[model samples]
Target: MPVQATSVRAPFDMPGILVPDFRHSRRFQITEFGARPGDKQSTSIAIARAIRAANAAGSGSVIVPAGIWLSGKIHLESNVNLHLARGAILRFSDDPQDYLPPVQTSWEGIECFNYSPLIYAFDCENVAITGPGRIEPVLDRWKIWSARPKLHMDALVALYDMAYRNVPVADRQMAIGQNNLRPHLIQFNRCRNVLVEDISIRGSPFWTLHPLLCRDVTIRRVSIQAHGHNNDGVDPEMSQNVLIEDCVFDQGDDAVSVKSGRDMDAWRLATPCRNVVVRNCRVLNGHQLMAVGSELSGGIENIWVDDCHFVGDGRGGDDHAVPINNLLYVKTNERRGGYVRNVHMSRVTATTLAGSVLAVETDVLYQWRTLLPTYVRRLTAIERLRVSDVHVQQAQSVAVIKGERDLPIQDVRLSRVRVERVSGTPTIVENARDVTLPAAVGRNGASALGADFKNSRRI
Candidate 1:
């Protein structure tokens, strides 16, 4: 049974965040454009025709009714809504040649001309992808691209150099011959007033749902179960006024990772991911329920996660039992110069957490340590992080907050947090200031009043 979440309140007024409505819109059917069900023929041209007809009709829906439609890529236009009826399945082709003529897309926060995402929209307004249907990408070819050979690493290094040297985005073309850079499943780039609701997504080539530099986005009642490499469920990068609610994430990486581009590219963009809210969500399995960076260089602020459930021990039989790495994780390194502040999480319930309930580390350089040379070392400023009313059934540690000696984390508070079983240290604090844990509990059925602190003061 799924755990029921309590009522959640948004931290700030979400004025412009509302679901887009298409009640009286006209419908352009894909079948009318010669699309057949279950045929091995590519439906790319047919779907594209249908979208063009819808767009030409002035704000309408391109309907895909109850069938398995195989396609290569889908490019959405302005004032158009792609709607799938119940039992509709849109399967994408796995061949790399299908998504040709690289469009304006990004590879891990660095802007480049790469292969288009499976469903892509660029600089459009009032666009949506809504349905009670499934969008699956056949990854037989993409899975091979997952291997990061020296060629891939060299390409990455080139991108980093170009970013630091302030190269024009048009000059950074990554889709050369035999260069395997995976594309996102769905990406809305520089779009406004986007809505994705009631959709089921599976088998992504890369990050599942990515909204880059978008504004006023709402993703509600969606289900994503993609476990491919680098398949983060939802990545809102450099986006603003976003809301993700009542979604289920069974991912291979962080469920909801809020990023603002990466180092030099991010500094160049100068757009912080701000005013995002995630509520009433369920994490069946993921690396973390919510993660705030390893790539945040443009800063992240005013994030709220409330009334969520993270079932780390899986939701099915024995094969499904994978413990979550952490419940709430904030990770940044010295090379990432950003500010993380005003983050609040409340009424979260979890079970079988492999790490601490809350873990914040500053020097978490996963592959960048050996991958690229640090161009500028700017320490992040993390402050005013608060977690409240959280209950964890089991965890390795209650909390671990590690900050840099030169730049300490400040004003962190954990209140009304309880853990049933803790097998490791209850709390570990270092290089912080004004840290307070009023109701932090552990396996001993007592408050964490005796935990040791290192280089921290004003508890």
Candidate 2:
């Protein structure tokens, strides 16, 4: 019973992208289902009942009034909108058992059966979680899971082996072994016509908002402040025709990370993440404004980011300044066999950055280098990256490109990029072709790119 709401065309350059509109949906209040404030079990049961009722009614909104409601895992049904009223605070419990009966989910790009995300929607259509309120976690227990001990690494290796062996997804389960794999805060898996709007998310155990294998998704006017490990604000993986706009992110990882999937599993699916638009967002703290991969074995293309900027002194949870590392970072390795192309970024501004404006590395394996031997060696092809009108007050460098010798990165273009002060080299290039930048070096011996430079050369 998916909602037959108006499917408004997305306001982006991508074709065939539609956003769900649930303006006239009926309301099913949780209070009417015997939900009480501060009672986790009651609220959880009541929410389930309300969702069931709403789904049975064809299309409806399960509303939470202005109160602090403690809940467990809240699963959404098709056509059901989980709406939180203005003063509502929907707080989730951190007890891992609450997310029991492991659902089909992925951890860090590989598919496995893990603890359910705090809010999960699977194979549903026209689902949403809208709020002018707040959603946070009772993160006492989850905090302990954040530190990746040896057990966690062992579990990841196990999952990698499973994927490498092409094991059936249903047989690859990680929830049974006290694996301590942190569950995502919210995930929409294999769903379509998704909309998440006007929500303020405070903390997350893992990635905050994830759209996996979804279509026609719109995330608008969302604010996130999650400072835990791997707390990437939004991860669009294997998704198409996505729009992320009017958002604010202060996170421990990248603000907006576009991923496809990991190695063998992704190659099997053969789905690429494409046609994504990120605009009019502000980053307070993050590793990168947008990171294309480290897990992109399924390929990524047609990404456009514009009118986004870094703001607010880039502070972290300890009240100390946490410098944003880079504006655009694309990372892959010899083990990843995919293609990255047609990425365009423009009209971005920042006060200070800890790393370069553009960074592309082909040898970033992170902890996986020693965790396990390379099961397979396949090179990734990265090309056609364009950056323009980026003005940063101070940064370490302008560009850093490290590509493989045989298949180097190709067609990198930067124009109207102004850096007030640079602490290091203007550009460092190796194994790349067709890199175009401004001709004039800065007064401080640093390089600032502008429109006047048009020559392209291999490095």
* Superposed Cα deviation of residue 409, candidate 1 (Å): 0.6
lDDT of 2: 0.88
User: Residues 318-342, candidate 2, lDDT per residue (tens digit)?
Assistant: 5633579899999999998999999
lDDT of 1 by residue, 1-459 (tens): 011122325776545574456777888888888888876353677889988887887778889899888888899998889998999999998887778789999988899999989899999888899999899889888899998888888888888888889999999999886668999999999998898989999779999999999988889999998877898889999998888999998887789999998888999899999989999999988888899997899999989999999864654222433458777899999988988999889999998888977899999987678987777999999999989999998888878999999999999999989999888778889999999875557656445666768999746
Candidate 1 residue spans exceeding 4 A from truth: 1-9, 39-42, 315-322, 445-447
Name the weakest run of 10 consecutive residues (lDDT summed) in model 2: 450-459
**Count of backbone clashes, every candidate in sequence:** 0, 0
Clashing pairs in 2: none
Would you estimate the TM-scores of all the predictions? 0.95, 0.95
